[model samples]
Target: MSTNALPPVVDTDTWQKELAALRIREKAATRELDAIAAQRRRLPMVQMPDYVLEGEHGPVRLAEIFGDHPQLIVYHHMWNDGAEWQCGGCTGFTSQFTRLEGLASFDARFVIVTHGPIGEALAYKRKVGNTMTWYSTANSSFGSDVGAPRDGGFAVNVFLRDGDTVYRTWHTDGRGTEQLSYLFGLIDILPYGRQEVWQDSPAGWPQGPTYSRWLDSDAIAAAYGEPN
Candidate 1:
């Protein structure tokens, strides 16, 4: 293997000392993230209108998406009208979450919402082997009202349900949504760190345009074969 693009080699004792020093900063960052999450938990929410979204079984109320769960996490997938494929970043990121049974124990449910028609969205979901329940906001203002308008980018949104009422709790997009992506998190810990041009890496480290290496739904489907 080539060491030209790798971190400098050092003595065992020296590496241990450097790793220990970095661990201290890592712990501090972890603690700061805990504090930020504490603040996020205390954030106020806003009541939402009774928006009806299109589902496989017809119109479904926003609150109904929660089912028996009190909390709902929605991934607003970016869509392209009449296109055969969708956003590669959104598709790859979302496809990582194929199973969410663990969230049920916490009284939380995760789902996907998009501006595409319900049929097309579900078709793409199957094509990409995405098992998450998906809904369509194409016929309602839910997409635009929740910061994921038609032709816009992807987003992550949280909602709370009380009886039949729903309230928007939190919304994040861009890099803020990275927390939900295990792919990004795993890549971030690597030496090259995403290998994206925007990242601060060593001079000889490999780099490419953002999302250039991301695979779209069709590519993922082709790689993994058709979903059963």
Candidate 2:
């Protein structure tokens, strides 16, 4: 059928039946996800040195980033080596992390670390209108070690701390980053569903450019600024 054709109209009973059937599959998927998560928690962890990173408040130890929490979730945000702008997808993804108050209440802490200069990272964060806690991996192997420090890439790492020592528990990248963005989950339920070129949408379903159109050198240049 042409993408222009809408889904078949169904009577209330039929619609409810289909919805019920889909819910069964959805529940199955949820169970699988839970199982995987349980396995993730059981995975072995590796010890890491207490590397120093640059935060808005100045230099801070990797362990300090966790504050009082024993668990840390850090996203290695792509900065293209201190470019004027940031990756659009990365920017869009990080924008979702507003206040971590709810997450912190559960004994978890989240922060963003980039290999860019601290000043530049703060400027970019401000320009993008994000309120997340950010730090710089400048002169530190923190990015290359457990995070994706390269351009056009992003990584979310899970770390566990034992007293003064830190251990990397797990890390994920690429589509894995979508796990943090409710937008992708929400869009997945829509008819067009992201509308990206590679998506398995119906033929002629208004597919546009992939996500790469979001940011580039020009945009970054306009977003960078000198701190006051």
- Please tell me which predicted candidate would have the highest lDDT against the true structure: 1
* Local distance difference test values of all predictions, in order: 0.89, 0.81
Candidate 2: where are CA atoms >4 Å away? Answer: 1-3, 212-228
RMSD of each: 1.5, 3.5
Residue 201's lDDT in candidate 1: 90
TM-score per prediction, in order, is: 0.96, 0.88
Top candidate by TM-score: 1
Quick one: how many clashes does candidate 2 have?
A: 2
Candidate 1 C-alpha lDDT tens digits along 121-218: 99888887777899999999998988998977888999999898899999999989988888888888888888889989989999999877788678
Per-residue lDDT tens digits for candidate 2, residues 105-198, read 8788999988888998887887777677999987798888775755436799999888989999999998887878887888889887787898
